[model samples]
Target: MTGRAHRDSEADRIWQMLVGLVWETRGEWRRKVSEATALPFSRVRILWRLVDEPKTLTQLAVSTSDAPATTVAVNDLEDRGLVERHPHPDNRRAKLVSLTPAGRRLIESARRTVRDDAPPAVQQLSKTDLAHLRRILERISSSER
Candidate 1:
């Protein structure tokens, strides 16, 4: 292969490896959070999204990227006393969804699960190696913006 073609192939391989690593870590984190919270990953995600402030159902749907699924998840969360809806001040037709005290406690537990369950490989990294990895990852993240 030409030098350019060889470089491109190597870059593709590295990109795939990085993507795989990220996905694996994400899946593991989700699993741990689900186990700790006794809720599906989807519900956990919605809870995390609502952490900052209340959101309309439409807003949640947009953020979650699945309107129908968001509706169903919100219904379930509401039924379980994890969330409550209050009339939106600006739009009489819309209601804003916010976490209840129970929801806050559960999400806090999930967050702790995430913090305490770092992947073993990452946990094993030396401080210097971790710093290098963080810098490289931050550079990659900033390049997209």
Candidate 2:
């Protein structure tokens, strides 16, 4: 085997590390940007889905991994003025969720938020190593979608 580790051998380690990074990245960004601890990371995801086009809560659930409480969360954001619900033109039974003007502003802020929390050790990575890391990660994840 020439002492090289096979890619599959790292699968479990990679999965654990990936989920851990998601929390670390989100927690750090939240601390650096907003005082609100309920940001949920789920809300950012829902907002991202609505960034281009509005969707109903059910659709948002489907898009957001069929989250169990998407309805409750959407209602909470609507109450906070972060999201606006508009009447669905084609389906009266459904409502479309869109980011408010304020929501747009919040997500714009989050874009910058993520960069602010990136670890300094990551800065030590060579440009090629960094690019390879990103490419490998994305390539591996594309199969999940």
Best by lDDT: 1
Q: If scored against the real structure, what TM-score would every candidate get? A: 0.73, 0.68
In candidate 1, which residue pairs get closer than 3 Å at backbone N, Cα or C atoms, i.e. clash?
A: none
Candidate 1 residue lDDT tens string, 70-111: 999999999999999999999999999999999999998777
Q: Which ten residues in a row have the lowest lDDT in candidate 1?
A: 110-119
Backbone collision tally, model 2: 0
For candidate 2, lDDT tens digit of each residue in 1-145? 3334666567768888878877766666656444342477777677778888888888999877655689878888888888999899999998889999888888887776556645766778899999999999799789888
Clashes per candidate, residues 3 or more apart or on different chains: 0, 0
**Which residue segments of model 2 deviate by more than 4 Å?**
1-9, 36-45, 62-68, 89-92, 110-117
